[model samples]
Target: MNSPELQNVPLFAFATAMEFSKVFPEDSSKAESQNQLIPLSGPFQGCFACILGVGILDFSAGLASLLFNCKQTNFKISAVISLGICGAYPDRGLSLLDVVNVSSDRVGDLGCEEQDGSHTLWDKSILGGNCCQAPAVIQKMLVALPQVVGATVNCCTGTATTAVERVKNMGCDVESMEGAACFAICQKFNIPAFQIRAVSNIASTRDKSQWKIEEALEKLHKCICG
Candidate 1:
């Protein structure tokens, strides 16, 4: 079922090895623990994919390995697709199992801190706003998928006040720890990229019961497989 253009596509995931395995059961072979990249094959489409772990550190390492692999195999990567679960700002009307296509991404915490405990967002003028957008070709490919603006941060918003502030500051619909980094890296290489995420919880609360990781993962798998 692989599209001719997507034969060697690299799909990146930021979940734990176990979580990734659950979603990609066809990648049953031990991902040669020799390097940062875990080689994978799509069960549905037979496209090349990899589980890049969670957060910025793993992402950096995996991206380097992926580039190296691409060069070694004389392969031209067709697309960079990231799939995972993310927290949502409740006001966006997103539920736990809703999957979203990241239309754009921004680093949520890359700004100066203030003395009075208040915070000001980075000036988009001087800094020119470090943001990445989904490629137009990808937009057309996944136009049926729900779209949202993603804010990437090292820390998740833990309070209602902070969530509201972030929405006002970044106009983001969903938040994750890795989306912006993935987007920026793709943009650097001038690669067409897509970031798809399933909402697992509301950013304003830390309650585990309120989150739905299993349901989100299931929906994410279906969205990516289709």
Candidate 2:
């Protein structure tokens, strides 16, 4: 019996380089070989539809390639979802292990500054504006998740000063590296896409001593499994 949820959509799951390695550790014997995509079997497999893991820089390109190749390879992919960790803004009152659902994403560092202090980027050139909105289903999922928050960023936002500046500008609940890029790709493909992030640290100052990466990852796994 075909499940309606798995009928056509392929769930694309993305994580940063470090995060990916942590979740999917490499086999020493296969170190030199390309990592192959295997069918993820579990509750998520049935509910997710299709799954693709992507890196930060290659997320958009990878999804496009996956969609194009999957057609030839006899896989039908419909939706994309990313799960990972991010920095939390102090003002949002989010703590370590809290999850965030992105409502939109923006390339915080892409725009060029003008003499008048105005900034602009590709969306401004092509669409006469700059805005990216996530799909409604994703938003609904975010609301359903336990202890979920909203996220945004200006630049990569790893450092204290940078994170503070971004929080002041965007007032987002969290910050991450690849959310905006993933949002851009999903928007282009007209795919229902969403982002889920676990807070590993406060967006204020970059303190390696205070990071709860392992704990956050554990919580994220629980969220996904639940």
Candidate 3:
């Protein structure tokens, strides 16, 4: 299948194949690369779709994969859209499968381990803040969606103590493995970016039964389509 035209083509980047399928299952056409698909209808109509599945859930991996895809596109990407699922903090009062427009993302594990074995946050004084801001225009467009501040890490917080510590240290309302990396890459390329996440589970505990993967994916699809 032929790729979407270079101009006005939104790069919808998914972190996994499952996530990609949720958005473009039926109309996805095989292109030059399995990771790349030409989407002809639905929310992805006339859009460039890419799956960053190799990374699984790691910040560095996300960063590398995103940059590589950007290079391969050979086009001035219109916008970088990182769309997937994330774990919401319990204190945020968000329900399962609620879509979130990530207003900002902080790299939660960017600092050193202290002598007391607690993690110390990186100094963001130079940049003036810890959180990486999302595009203002995207934020305006997503005003109807729930907005969340997210923290990205290599691993999700699985225990109560760690969860509390994470919130205290990072001041984030949700957690994901790739949001911050997506933001950074977009900033470097001077492209506007948006990280939209659907809540799949509570970050406080490691309970798969409590997760809503399908519902979250559906919400993600609907939010994007609208």
Candidate 4:
């Protein structure tokens, strides 16, 4: 079948579990136990739709694919975005409140071990390859945000050293849990997509006290709204 002609493209933004909780307070009446959609008005004008409760790896991937498959006004989504908080490696020069534009993503932890003890998971080339490029419209929209940085990685870097090594290896500016999955889904559907992340903490030793989650989430709201 032919792709539907959409007047306005729908933007799908995904946030982490904690950020989602803050953005959409739990409603007991809703049987799902998690808030899924947070509608916006005014400047967003309903064109921008946020998908919360997408913290789980498989769930997030499935949800994004499901949305893409759903019969909206058009067959293909105008754009898909994952806006949330991520861990930044200090060596990469990213500080809290800095936004990261994901140029690429990969399953950092999904690989098999070789006889030489080297592990290999899906790489950026395998996920979308050179053919996977960010949408021009999304890039234009991001140019207005000066603090935005760019990054790519295959797995989540939770430790300082691991974060640093991955940054050095992949040349990415930040780390998160689900961008690769989002990228994979978009690529599979031939849909245009982008990922923007606000740095909430240093990708160092586990330390919750250092995270600026609330501030990052607020910044994310503003960025997407803008």
Count of clashing residue pairs in every prediction: 0, 4, 0, 4
Q: In terms of TM-score, how similar is model 1 to the real structure?
A: 0.80
lDDT of 4 by residue, 157-215 (tens): 56777766555656666667767666666666666666777788887687888889899
Maximum-lDDT candidate = 3
Error of 3 at 189 (Å): 0.7
Model 4 CA lDDT for position 53: 43
lDDT of 3 by residue, 57-173 (tens): 443465455556656666456676788899988787788888878878877877999899898888331111112433333445466676678888777889988899988887788
Sorting all predicted structures by TM-score, with the top scorer first, yields 3, 1, 4, 2
Model 1, which residues run further than 4 Å from truth? 1-8, 28-46, 123-141
Which residue pairs in model 2 clash with each other? 9-78, 10-50, 10-78, 11-50
- The collision pairs in model 3 are none
Off by over 4 Å in 2: 1-7, 16-36, 46-56, 72-74, 113-141, 146-155
lDDT of each: 0.68, 0.55, 0.69, 0.57
Which pairs clash (backbone N, Cα, C closer than 3 Å) in model 4? 107-154, 108-154, 108-155, 111-121
| Candidate with more favorable, higher lDDT: 3 or 4 | 3
RMSD of each: 5.0, 6.1, 4.5, 5.1
Q: In candidate 2, residue 89 scores what lDDT?
A: 77
Instruction: Give the Cα error of residue 214 in candidate 4, in Å.
Output: 0.4
User: Tens digit of lDDT per residue, candidate 1, span 1-226?
Assistant: 2235544555454546555655666664654343344556544443455667677667757776775666566666656777788998978978888887777887788787789766676623111112243333334446777778888887898988889888988888899887777766666665666777888899985788888988888877776655
In Å, residue 90's CA in model 3 sits off its true spot by 1.4
